[model samples]
Target chain A: MDVALDTLKFIDLTTANIIFLFIVGFIGGLVSGFIGSGGAFVLTPGMMSLGVPGTVAVASNMCHKFPKALVGAIKRFRYGQVDIKLGLVMAASAGVGVQVGIKLQNFILDKWGQSGSNLYVSLSFVAVLVIVGGYVFYDAMTADKSGKPEAVAPLALRLQKIELWPMMTFKTAGVRISMWFTVPVGFATGMLAATIAVGGFIGVPGMIYVIGASGLVASATELVIAFAMGLGGTINWAMHGMVDIRLTVIILAGSLLGVQLGAIGTTIVKESLIKFVMGSIMLIVAVSRALAVPKYLAELGLLDVAPGTVAIMDKASFLIMCGALLMGAVIILGSMYKARKAHARQEQEAFGQA
Target chain B: MAHEMTKKQAVVRMIGFGAASAAVFGGIFLFANPLTEIFSRGGMYAALPIATVFLVSYVHGGFASNLWTALGITAKQPAKTLRPTATKRPEVRATLNA
Candidate 1:
């Protein structure tokens, strides 16, 4: 694999390219900080569009991801939101999930070739995001309407009641459930992550709905899982000599700054806002991926589509993907601003009363 | 007392780390070719890039964290621990009927 990897060309960093990577990195970091996982899904494709080989883009993006996760995990830890034991527990199972995911990917690539693989990935994104993201969004809206910001899923409550073998309690997440239940959620998160680079989409929601962690805890705890998985993934890619250090560093510059602001944001905003933002981004990205499906279908010779139309759809898909990240950033920042203003007003009222 | 830094101290540390981080990035661009050659060699050389990212992240991540605190964009401290505002029921009176 390393010998084969040697032949793939890495892109030169023109000033324009460097600037683009830095800006995308910041937005991606900001989103990841708020939601627990994002940016890589955009960064990998974003890099490739700039003439970077697919493998190099993935490898370099991965190289930056783990460290960023490490920093985020630490920052959130100070706020007492991270559940280290749970994150490690889920990460252990996610490791197995990644292996299975890779096997499935290889199987698809072998059977259908590149175009078929593309279609499969896109459809998976649509199906999973629509079902899961819709549920999360609906839950957020319901919580808002009822004025109950913290509501556990019925499934989680039932699971917690059951007296099963090896029940573990996560103090920070405030969850006591059978270890067996956690495995499936963790495994699914890993599998999704393997299929799509952003496993946090499934991982965070799985923690909230299935494991019964609050949105803040779930999102924060995800950084630990991300750090573990990203580290392993980076090492594997690096061993193949696929990491482009320059791109890794350039992206790192922006993401580090963005992630810290994101971590602070969790402290100021309502927990449900995390779900609202995560769910919104997931659905938008799903649509963006859906738009690319026709292009892949045409490539597979299943649909007779004009080349011009395919090109237009491709650009639309990429633009929508970028829009999803931007939208998440705006929501997070807007909520933060509102919260800060409210805090200031309360302080003034307290002073007046005193 | 030693554990706490004044705002001025924090700003100074942030500046120092920011400069160091910038220097590291500048060095990477200056020695881009040689570093890439050494890093891309698989096997034992894989550690080169891994170590480089870890080192760079430490300095840069520190700078970013300090910059936020210095700018007063810090996390909200939980108020629950400081307040004892749990409301008590009003006292019941056992008086003769008027």
Candidate 2:
């Protein structure tokens, strides 16, 4: 397939297209603000669906993401959810992880070209989502059964016990662990993020189980890591003239709105709800990526699949990705509504007392 | 309670956001021809997208923040039940040192 590089001409964008990008950006932003990492997964494909080249879509999305993450981190900071120190530490190490991830990605690209690289990414997505999502779901269920609020994992507790040198304490996250443990987890998260673009699945769980951060703090901190990674990636892509600014700005428009609302919604919900939503999205996203595996396998001739079947599978993959975002939106909106009502009732009670 | 901005304040924010967004959109439109031409210049062409992203993040980012405030969707104080401390922690001894 001849990939036309000239397809990225700016005049191709229309007013209607700009409006659509803005709306999508807002929604993507809202989801990220709440969940810490999501908008890129949706925005990149969303732009591609509108005829933007794949690389251009990804590049433009990356360009818009860092600033949006910056905005989100600031807002969540005001809500007292962010651990700037932890986030910065994680980001620093995650940068190295991203370099490693890119090196691995380039190696894969060298060997397999585009299809093989896609296969590797989809497979990793499936593997990580299933393993991590299942564990989170099972944990959430067990916590519910025990009638205990979902607490930090025992692994985190045990890790904290290891009195290694440089016992850094994340006061906001309420954990004291060795910098050794924290750095590795942050690096791994960055590596996975560079590969699949959604590092939160690994980063959040890693923080909870390995580093002992609360779900809220872990998720919020992921935004900072995301900011660092996105900024770095954007500069790399921009150097290639691959970024479509119009597309990026449009997505930013929507995402910014979505992210702020998502951040605010965090104030009203229970910690377990975060786990539940994260688990649910991860599982669904796993299935979505799983749908793409066969197509890649077919391309590699590892399997004999029909072309029509491949096309259908590709569409299914896109739908499942959208489904993941929709599921996330539903959870955030539902929880926010409940929280808002509860807040109003509390205010009314205070008024009555007065 | 929702912060009820006086009519003047509301108008000012509205106009501010509106003008900024318009200017951004207008800038993109006005430069559409030249920007596209420069972007395709290739080689050291990386700066075009980098600079554009920074510009968008600033202009559009401000709009998104103000837009959220206008929508009555703002962060509330942490609940009394989950009032974790927001204090910064002191640095711990390095593992090798300890």
Candidate 3:
């Protein structure tokens, strides 16, 4: 029963494509591992550039994501970074959010066609990345300058004080905000995942600012949220026959290894460094999406640009996205290298003292 | 203590899990077309992909962890959570939203 999906055609796996997927998957997994969310923003677009349709790319990425999130979550939980209760509450609401977001995406696809859907995805990427990415970056820079840990956001402190009924406390996160406060963040995470195939851009910050989780706990917990988002999303997209299982499995082969390295990163670096990496990548990815927007707009006849211009824009966008991946790899690997060196030197000193 | 898995033990488990992972990937590629068709059938059959992903994560995740441990890239002396998992299943159970 070798059935083909009508909306998505699987491209032949050339040697290059296989190598590319594994490499990209590793980088994506690494990012996802450290921040508890990422890789999808890169992987989805990465798949699309490799000739997969937008929805198929999203679906395939989602298929890989839940499992990745599961692995990352378990790893971080062992370190006491994940709050299962918080992740669960957020994930439940995120499920509802995913349903709503997917409905809107389908509606756009039906009404406006493929280019429109593509344009919608691109615009969403730019908007979310710019707004959320900018905020996260600002917070990271300010925290770094303060030469102290991320000072608890006063908002988080105040929100925790609300004596609402059913106050939920995450012991690892050391936060006691009400369930009322947590669900909306989860729901929004789901919605973002459905639309852009990524929710951690919002989920991590939401946990930090609104729910009072520290950057480490917030990021680790985001893995749980990512898993929930991915599970619900994969189901929704698969039910529509949009998933390219080939892409999913191939990406998994690389990401599985990358994610472990990334999860180790959290232990090696400061919490502020996580935010900085997360923020820097987000802002750069936003630029990448912004570059692609005009191409989609011109395709829809919303702009009168020449076809060559559109092609150029598309190429530039993909290249820039690749650059974003490179930057992420450099920062992550670089940090890991430095941390390992410091750790070794410390061990050597301790031995000498003994 | 770090789950009592020695570096030597981790290396052995890494090889074991690595072989299992390779087998699974080999099976998928060898039977790619049929696997895709069944997994992408759409409907409650979504479970096919979900379950596959979960299985892959467990097997491959184990490999990655062991690989790291064998390399000595573990957490800093791993301060285990002496506290039990404080919050149980969904927080609403613990919540008193009258």
In terms of DockQ, the best-performing candidate is 3
Candidate of highest TM-score: 1
lDDT score of residue A219 within candidate 3:
88
Give the docking tier of candidate 2.
acceptable
Native-structure RMSD, model 3: 4.7
Instruction: Give lDDT tens digits, candidate 2, residues A240-322.
Output: 77776656666776777788788877777766667777888889989988999999898898999999998998898888888
Clashing pairs in 1: none
lDDT of 2 at A180: 89
Better of 1 and 2 by lDDT: 1
Between candidates 2 and 3, name the one with more favorable DockQ: 3
**Better model by lDDT, 2 or 3?**
3
Chain B, per-candidate TM-score: 0.71, 0.57, 0.74
Docking outcome class, model 1: incorrect
**Model 1, CA-based lDDT:** 0.86
Per-model C-alpha lDDT, please?
Answer: 0.86, 0.77, 0.81
All candidates' TM-scores? 0.92, 0.87, 0.88
Provide the lDDT at A313 for model 1.
Answer: 91
Residue A80, model 2: Cα distance from true site in angstroms: 1.4
Error of 2 at A111 (Å): 3.4
